[model samples]
Target: MKLRDLGGVVLAVLLLAGCSTSPVTEGQAKAISSDRVYAPDLVGRADSESAKATFLRDEGYFGSGCSHVIYVNNRKAFAIRQGEGVSLRLQPGEYSFRLETGAGMCPNIATSQDITLKPGSAVTYRILLPSDGNLRLTRIQ
Candidate 1:
């Protein structure tokens, strides 16, 4: 793609990115990710609250340019670039987590994993970026 074309695609992606609420917070992302974070909308509870689950994206530079979006229960929860991570505070339940590429110019790639969250327990999921074509979401903590 040419320079202007790539710029248009990035602009379009930025505009479309704000349409949803991300479960991850900017503060948490900054603390974990070694790269950059695109999705930072807070959709989870506070640290003082009774948090049941936490989702973190792996810190890597393989897919740094594309927005690595994390989907929880089939919804867009957050987008973490290479080296970026998110800590989410969620309620107790069974949640399906997945990874996807950002809209426009990004590859249509994805991977998913399921976990059951219990009360007074903290569950964690991790998204590993290996390439622009696909990503893996696995339980790490």
Candidate 2:
């Protein structure tokens, strides 16, 4: 490749990268905004003393038909489908969270994460199945 052509190629690559975003900002930005929370059947009602927790399922084709389960402090909290979300008003404390699909790669894996939520504060978690098919529970915002 010529030097001038390579410079042009590098510029193009940089511009493309700039146009994209991190994984946390990805997947239906319009729907995942803080105000647009999903509250099916008024699940997890929040009071002035409760912290808001939201979980969003990735908008991917992998495991689209499977139900994604959310465990808060080792208890079954919510089950969400693809491109869907759930909001829970939880009591603030140190919490352990885990995600399970019961299908796809590493189905029985017990990978989990922990977070400390404060009363009257809000947080969100995202469930994603990447190209490799491993399930992940990521805290986004």
Candidate 3:
């Protein structure tokens, strides 16, 4: 291959190598927690007073009443709630949170939103209900 072509190939490989899902370095993880507040909005039946909040840990779902979510840093998932706000400490990176709502009479109502968190940053999102009873995600910060 031509020298220029070979160099281009090497550069491409390096760029792709930088894209990985491994947890951030220890220093980076610590920095992330201090830098940002990862708060997502929780909108629900408008009558749900359980303060139910759900988040994804290394194991699995940590709480109940979590229907919708926002992925943060590819490492954590924040669940949507109603009224009351939810909070969590997570490593820095990119995430996608899937928003959901109640079932049965409220089954058909659901919505989701995406958010990206940087190291040492706080993200505040919103959960709201449409007039028709469907749910929608709103980012506050």
Top candidate (lDDT): 2
Runs off by more than 4 Å, candidate 3: 1-81
Query: Which tens-of-lDDT digit does each residue in 4-90 have in candidate 2?
Result: 999999998876554332343334532333333233333546788888877777665556656666777777666666667666777
Better of 2 and 3 by lDDT: 2
Worst 10 residues of 3 by lDDT: 55-64
Best prediction by TM-score: 2
Q: How many clashes (backbone N, Cα, C below 3 Å) per candidate?
A: 4, 0, 30
Q: Give the Cα lDDT of each candidate.
A: 0.59, 0.66, 0.41
Give the TM-score of each candidate: 0.58, 0.65, 0.42
lDDT of 1 by residue, 10-63 (tens): 997875553222323334555545233333444445554445455555443345
Candidate 2 lDDT (Cα, whole model)?
Answer: 0.66
| Root-mean-square deviation of every model | 11.0, 7.4, 17.0
If the candidates were sorted by their lDDT against the true structure, best first, what order would they fall in?
Answer: 2, 1, 3
- Runs with alpha carbons beyond 4 Å of true place in candidate 2: 1-42, 103-106
- Which parts of model 1 have CA positions greater than 4 angstroms off? 1-42, 46-50, 102-106, 131-134
Q: Once model 2 is optimally superposed onto the true structure by TM-score, how far is the C-alpha of residue 52 displaced, in angstroms?
A: 0.7
Put down candidate 3 lDDT per residue, 5-32, tens digits, no spaces. Answer: 9999999877555422222221222211
